[model samples]
Target: MPGIEAGGIAVVLVARSAIAAAPRAEMERLAGQVSGLHEIALATYAFTEQGQPALREVVANLRRRPFREIRLVPLLFPMEASFRAWIGRTLARWQLEWDTEGPAIRIGPGPNASERLTDLVSDLVETAGREKPFMPAEHPATTGSVVAAAHRRVLVCQGGPCNEAGAAAIWGHLRNEQEGQSLRTAGSGMMSATTSCLGPCSLAPVVQVWPEGTVYGGVNEAGIDAIIREHLLGDRPVESLAYPANGRKQALRLRE
Candidate 1:
C-alpha cells in the first residue's frame, strides 16, 4: 500500500532572544533567505518546560515519518550559560536519541553573527552614519604603527573531535568563500585559516575570528557563510553565535 507523508521535514529552532535579548529578527530573516525543508522558532517556549517537549515531539515525529534528514538549529547566543549547559545538554540528549533511531541527524550550524555573518555586518557598518568614523587606530586585526585593521581572520578548529564532526568540510568552504577576495575590498576578511585544537572538546566543530575573539561552535558550511556575510562583511557582530572566554553568562557586546 502506498503511504502518504504527514510532514515535509521537522526542524526545531531553539532561540534565546528572551533571556539574552539578543537579535532574533535578523536570524529569522536569514533563515527565511536560506532554503530549507522546514523551520519552527521556539522563541517563547525556549525558556519554558513546553519547549523541551516540543523539541522531543518534533524529533519523534520526524523519526516516525520516513525521512532521510532531520535538523536542529540552536539560535541562542553561544556563550549564554543556560544555553551552554542547559540547552547543550538537552540537544545532546536529542542527538543520542536520534542516533539510536538511525536517521541522518544534520545539526544546522550557528550560535548567529558567525564568521561569515560578519561580511553582512561590515556592509551595514559602512552605510551607517553620515560620515564614516576613522577606523580604530588599533583595530583588533592589525598590529604595529599601521594600527591593526581587525581583518576578521576565521580560525576553524580541525582537532580530532571537530574534524570527525565535519570541521574539515566547513573549513574548506570558509577558505573557498574567501579566496582571492580581500576583506577591505569586499569589506570582509583580513585573513581566514583552519587551525588545530580550539580546546573546548564539548563544543567541537568550532570557528573563531578576531577583534572580539568571537567563537562559533556547531558550525558548518552555511554557518561559515553566515559569519562571513553578516559579521565579517557587515558592521554588526553576530552576538548570538559567540563563545566567550568565561563560562559565565553576560550581556553580549556587539563590538569589541
Candidate 2:
C-alpha cells in the first residue's frame, strides 16, 4: 500500500551513512507492517561528530520536497550529549528557517523498540509461520516473569536536571490527580514513588515505567495531568505526552 499521506509530516532519520543504513532498512521493513508513517528520509552523517553537513543535506532535500511538517528521529540511543545538543541547535535552525521561509517542521521521538519495532517481529513471524503458525501459548516462558503479577510502582526522577526541569511540580500534580482516585491494573493499585535521574538530561524530567521499563522524556505540567489520567488510570501509554530522545528507537526491556 502507498505510505500514509500525513498531510505535511516527513519522517527524517538522523544517522551516519553506515549505521543508519541498516536501521533505516530495518525501519522500512518494520514500517511496512504498520500504517500511518510520515514520508521518510535518512540523514547522511554520524552522530559522534557534528552533523552540519548531513543536516544541511537533509534540510535542503526537505526544502525541495516541501513537507509542511517534519518529525526527526535521531538514530542514536540513551540521550547522550550528541543527541541532546543536536536537538536544541538543529530544531531552532529548522524553526527559524520555517518562519523565514516556509513549511514548519514538528518533532517527535526516535523509534524505540517498543513503539516502532513490532513491525519487524510481525514480519518475521509472518514469513516463518508458513509451515506452522506461530503461537505464544505453545511456547513456554524462557524465563520467569519480568514483572510481579501484581506490582505497583511510580518512579519519579529527582536528579538535578529533572528537579530543575520542574519534576517537583509534576510529582505534586500526579499525587493530587492520583489521590482519592484509585487505579488498578492486573490486580493492585499503582504505588506512586520517586527515584534518581533517568539520565535523559537533555530532555529533562524523565519518567520511567516499571515492570514495563518504558521511559518518557520532555515532560511538564500539562503532561503530568494527561499521564495520570490516561496511563495511570487506564493502564495505557499516553503517546502524545512523550517527546523524542537520543534515538529514533530503542526498547528498554523489562527483562534481559
Candidate 3:
C-alpha cells in the first residue's frame, strides 16, 4: 500500500466484470502508484448476468466507512455514450434515493484509450508475432449451445424502465441468491435470464417465474428475499407480492 495517499480517500477503479467483482494484483498496485489515493478498489458500471460487483454497492459500503471522499475511476473505455451517461445518472440517483448523506462522491476521468492503450496494444501485437497464442480447446464452439435441463426459469427484466430502476442489481442479486442457495441448473434446476419486459410497467420493476408465469411486482433487494424463500425455494409463492393477487399457477412445471 506504499505511495498511496494516507487520508480517508477511496479510489474506485471501474474495471471489467471479474476484476471489479474482486479487485486485486496489478490493477490495485497501479492505482496506488499512479493516483496515490488513500484507498483503491474496483467496481463495475453495472451488474451482470453472473451477478458481479456493482458500483452502487461499492460506493454504499465506502460511504459507511470513514472516508471523506470517494473517487470512481472507470477502467472500461470505448463504450456507448449512453452507457457512460447512465453511470453518471445512476450515481446521482443513488445520492437522492439513499436517506443518509455521507462522504462526497466524485467521478475521475476515465483512461484515454488511444493515448493510454495504443502502446500496450502495439506491444501485444509485436509480442504475439514471436510468442504463440493460447491453444484453442478441443471441444467444438457449439459445445455449449444445447439448452439447459432446468425445472424453473427466472426472468429479471433489464431493458426499458427496469434498467433505470436498478434492475441490473436486482438481476445480479437474484442470480447470486440462486447460486448461494444451491439452486442451480444441476441442483434445484433454476435458470435465470435477463429479459426486455414482463408487462405491468406501472409495477415499474418486476420479476417473473417461468412456466407458472408468476410475476412479482414492486420488487427490491429486500423483496427478493421473500420471493426466494417462498416461491423459488419453497412450495408457495410470496402471496403479498403476487402481481395480480391470483396469477400463480398451481404447481411448478419442469422439463428434463
TM-score leader: 3
Instruction: Name the 10 consecutive residues with the lowest summed lDDT in model 2.
Output: 42-51
Give per-residue lDDT, candidate 1, residue 26. 51
Model 1 has an lDDT value of 0.55
Which regions in candidate 1 have their CA more than 4 angstroms from the true location? 1-150, 180-184, 248-256
The residue-by-residue lDDT of candidate 2 on 59-175, one tens digit each, is 556655545565555665444443444455544644554565644554445445347568866897888877775567866768865553445577778787776665644565455
The residue ranges of model 3 lying beyond 4 angstroms of the native Cα positions read 1-7, 19-54, 88-98, 112-117, 133-149, 185-188, 199-203, 245-256
Q: Per-residue lDDT for 84-138 in model 3, tens only?
A: 5556765776676677888888865565634658887789889889986788789
Residue-level lDDT tens digits of model 1 in 110-132: 55637766786678677786576
Q: What is candidate 3's CA lDDT for residue 94?
A: 69
What TM-score would every model get versus the actual structure?
0.38, 0.35, 0.68
**C-alpha lDDT of residue 56 in model 1:** 45
Mind sharing the TM-score for model 2?
Answer: 0.35
* Clashes within 3 Å, all models in order: 42, 9, 0
